[model samples]
Target: MLTALKLTAFGVVDESTLELGPGLTALTGETGAGKTMIVSGLGHLLGARADAGIVRRGAPRAVVEGRWEVGDGIAGRVREFGGDVDDGELVTLRQVSAQGRSRAVVGGAGVPVSTLADLVGEFATIHGQSGQIRLSNPDRQRELLDEHARPAELARYRADFAERRAAAHELAELESEAMARAREADMLRFGLDEIAAVDPLPGEDDALAAEQAKLMDLDELRELAAAAHEALSGNENDYDAMGVVGLTGTARKSMTRLSDRDEAAAPLTARATELAMLAADLAADVAGYIDDLVADPLRLEAVSGRRAALATLTRKYGATVDEVLAWAASGAARLAELDGSDSRIFELRDRIAGLDSSLAADAAAISAARHRAAGELAAAVKTELAALAMPHAELRFDVSDAQLGPHGADRIELLFSANPGSEPAPLGKVASGGELSRVRLALEVVLATGGEGHTFVFDEVDAGVGGAVGLEIGRRLQRLAEKSQVIVVTHLAQVAAFADAHFVVAKASDGQVTTSGVRSLTHDERAAELARMMGGESDSDSGLSHARDLLARAGRG
Candidate 1:
């Protein structure tokens, strides 16, 4: 429920504050007294488009603010917008500049105007002449029916529809790229097969290159080994020049003889024996190395050929055998994915088929629920219409199958007939402006039952309606206010007479600026305002008497 509204520099309302209560509140004034500005201010507060032209002369900007009694339904949304709901109230503020810039604030947090719109249904529902026009829309009709009929089931069906839509979208993309994916898979397969045939091992390229270098210089290596062996031990033909091994042995014999002569010589003898052993070992190793040096051209060619093969792989896949192996591993995994594309496609197709079946079932259930609800809603509206001075009026819901959509597979339309024994026609085609207003009101009274705490604003809901019908409209609004806060802007005395609280918007001019001010009327003041609305002077005795009668009839006297 909206507790209050304030407007500054908005329309002809330079500055005004309306303190509201939780029941039917009526805004009444003479024509052109800016009564509708109250509704306009509320619209702007609820995120309607702001017009710079509405800004009052000499005012730089226009601002509209509202205070609402917060409920659990809107607390989460307020929190989602980074708003604070301390003290169980939410203050929403909107400002529009003459330069065409607009800003919104909810619960003291600045937000986009769209955030306010997102909270519309949960917070309030604005019904006016424009709303009546919207009621003729088939989509709007379907929405109202769903809102009253099967909200929970419709929610479930919509959720499933969203998931199914996403799956179908993915399937379409995969199918469209089928040819490209197939080509990619084939390329990966070929690369994998080629790498497998090579059978490259980690570090094999570097090892092969080292071996090939050694084999290519085999002759030089063998000559060097033979020279080292001859130097370490005496050559077979050059025995005159003793090698290190023979000379070391001669020195060892002398050291052994000296050690026997003196104890000090024993340490020198041990050192000489160690030196002789080291020389012998070195000589034997050199000899073995020379004997093992055998050069085979065929082996060299084999090593070179293997190195070239590895180089080919390195050129295409990686700079090293290890890297090439890594690529092969990764490629094999990707190839597996590509290979399973067909199976994945089949899986998605099967899933889509299953979803289609599920959607059909859910849509059927939703339609059935709507059918049941349509009958009840139509009958109820007819009853409401009968009370609103249209006893012979009939309302029918035309529920038919439509293509599956986000909401459901149902096309709903509201049909109406003004007289008995007449076939009901589409609401937009047959209903007059007056009939449309009443129909809109009837729907509101019916729907308002489900919206317990919502604030309902009706701007000229009595348009094109008056007399007994206007009285009935007032009564219906008063009844709706029993469960929801209803604020109406009217020029009809009949409707204003039924208000729990009456506010009169009066215009004042100081020759330079005209301003509209709103003030709650006292009992006598309300009668006088109603007298003015009845096209009579407020001071007329007869008008006052009639006004009193009107209020007494509505139980507000």
Candidate 2:
């Protein structure tokens, strides 16, 4: 239930605060006094989008705040949204800026706008002459029927359904992979076998290729080595031309002779001696390597075979030994899966069969319970309709099979017969606007009875009614308020006359500016307002007398 509302710079409402109460309350004013602004403010507080044009003329920003008292009825839900309420007392508020930014707060802590809307929704419903379109939406209708059928059971069923759906989805993905795998299974096995026979190791390809090139050029290498050795140190190429070491020794002896006369000659002599020693070491190495450089065909064959094995692995699996090894591991896993595909699929079918049996039983139980509830609900609605001046009308609840879903195959339709001897038809195709309002009100009254949390507001439900009918509508609204809180926006004097608290929405002009306002009326003052609604001027005697009589009767309730 809403405790209070505070508005500033919102629409034509400059600044105002309204403290609400527990029983029938009415708001009435002349045309264009901004009675609808209150509803618009409530809509904004509910997280509904608003137009910036609704801001006041001189104000830079608009704000509308509502404080709702949520006691034991929805405390758990409120706490779940990051708000704590005592017993069921929850305070929720919304603030909007002129720049189009909005904020929602619950229990003085900030929360998401959607959270605020969801939490506030559990408390009040804003039903106007247009009715609730969201409720009529196909998806919303499906949810309402499901809720009406089995709330807790449906909740658990949905949880299980999600898991089963996820498992089925996973099976589909695996099946697709398995299909592609099936076509390549033979090729994969053959290629893997070939690579295994090759048995290439990391870096083995480079080593083998280097060895093969060396073996292929062995003859040229031998000829070049012998010729190079002869040129540098052998007698064949060194007959008149001194070998490098012999020449260096001669140069060193000549420098030693000149060293006594020149300091630079000593360093030259030292360098010449160092060159002779290096020539000696090189000649020794050349002689030693000559026999070791022989090409061994057996070893060469082994190197070539290793190189070929590396080539095979690279071609079959990947560009490298490590990549081929990884493919081998994944192939092992996939082969195992392929071997067990049939068995796994059978397992899933068996599980699904068991689930189907259990779900069938659960659904049947739910259907049986719903059949009983529908009968009781229909009888109750018919009784309320009779009190609303439709004694001859009848209501029916038809539950039938729907699609296979978590909710267990139930579709419901409301059947209505508005006249004697008339065949009952579905509510959607047959009920008129006025009839719908009465029916909605009757349902609200019936369902909300003895339930937790109530702040009911009906806006102009008496639009197309008058006399006894209008009075009965007001009477029922008041009767409902006895169990909870009720507020009404009406043009009917009978309706206004029933309000324990009456607010007259009046327009005032302060020189150049005109503004709408609201003021709670006293008993005598409320009589004048009701008289005005009865199509009488403020001072009319008969209107005052009638308003007094109506108020007196409503006060007794």
Candidate 3:
């Protein structure tokens, strides 16, 4: 429920604050006195498009703010957006600058203007001349019928329709790309076969390169080994020159002779013996290495050829053998998917066929529900019209079969007739602007019977209506307000008489500036305003008497 609204520098309003409450509140004033500005201010609070022209001429910006009693539905959404809902109320603020820029704040947190729609749209509905115009659209007619008739059935049908659409989309994609996928599959298979031929192992490339270098210089390697062995241990032809092993043996014998003469020389003799043993072991290892060296051109040729094969794979697939193997593994998995395209396409088609069957069943259920509801709704609205002074008028709902759509397979139209024994025609053809307004009101009253709580704003719903019909409209609005808040902008005294609260918009002007303000009316002030609305001087005795009687008739005396 909207608790309060404040507007500053907006439209003709310099600054105005309205404290609203539950039940019907009527806004009445003379023409051009700026009653519509209240409606415009509420529109801004509801995230309607902002216009710089709406700012007061001398003001830099216009601001509109509203306070609402926060319900669970909206409070949860506020928390989702990191906003605070302190004290069970939510504050929404909108500002429009002269440069056409707009800003919105909700629950004391800045947010995009569009967020207001999600937070506030469900709780309030604004009906104006444009709303009446929308009533003529065929799609809008169908939507209203669905909303009234079979909301649950319609929801189920839409869900099934979405599933069917997704299945169809997948099937179309698979069929369109059949040839391209087949080509891709073949390329992956060819790469996998090439890698399998060499079957390279991890680290094999570097190991083979090292072996190849050694084989290429086999003769030089053997000659170097033989020279080193001869140096470590003298050959039989060079026995006259002592080798490292013979030199160390002579040093050990001299140290031992000295140690026999003096006990301290024994430590030196032990060191000489250790050096002689190490030299002998080194000579034996060199001799073995010389014997192991052998030139084999067959093994060299085989190693070189294997290295060439590995190089070819590295150049084509990866920088190294390990990387090449990784590519092959991933390619094999992808090939499996591409190769199974035919099976996947078949699966999608089967799913689509099943969804199509379910969708048809759901649509049939929705249509049946709509047909039953249409008859009942038409009867109820026709009854409402009778109280509004159209006793002979009839309302009919025409439900016919249509091709499957997201909504359902039913096409709904509202038909009307204003005279007895006349054939009912489409609403646009049979109803005048006044009849249209009454019809819309009748429908809203009927549909809103058990709906969630909302704040309904009716801007001139009594247009082209007066007399007892205006009283009936006012009565109905009062009744509607029992379940929700109602704010109506009207000029008819009969309508304004039923208001639980009344506000009058008055204009003030100096030589160079004009401004408008809104104020709640006292009991006597309301009576005077009603008199002015009745086309008489506010202080006229006869006008006040009539106003008093009207208020009494509306049960407001």
Off by over 4 Å in 2: 8-15, 31-33, 44-63, 71-91, 95-103, 108-110, 130-152, 161-178, 184-191, 217-292, 326-344, 504-519
TM-score, cand. 1 vs. native: 0.79
Against the unseen true structure, what C-alpha lDDT does each candidate score? 0.89, 0.73, 0.88
Report RMSD for candidate 3. Answer: 4.2
For candidate 1, write residues 397-477 as lDDT tens digits.
999999999988988888999999999999999999999989988998898887777899999888888999999999988
In candidate 2, clashing pairs total: 4
Ranking by lDDT: 1, 3, 2
Answer with 1 or 3, whichever has the higher TM-score.
3
| Tens digits of per-residue lDDT for model 2, 243-292 | 77677777778887888689878888888778888887887788677766
Best by TM-score: 3
Clashes of each: 0, 4, 0
TM-score result, candidate 3: 0.84
> Residue 440, candidate 1: how far off, in angstroms?
1.1
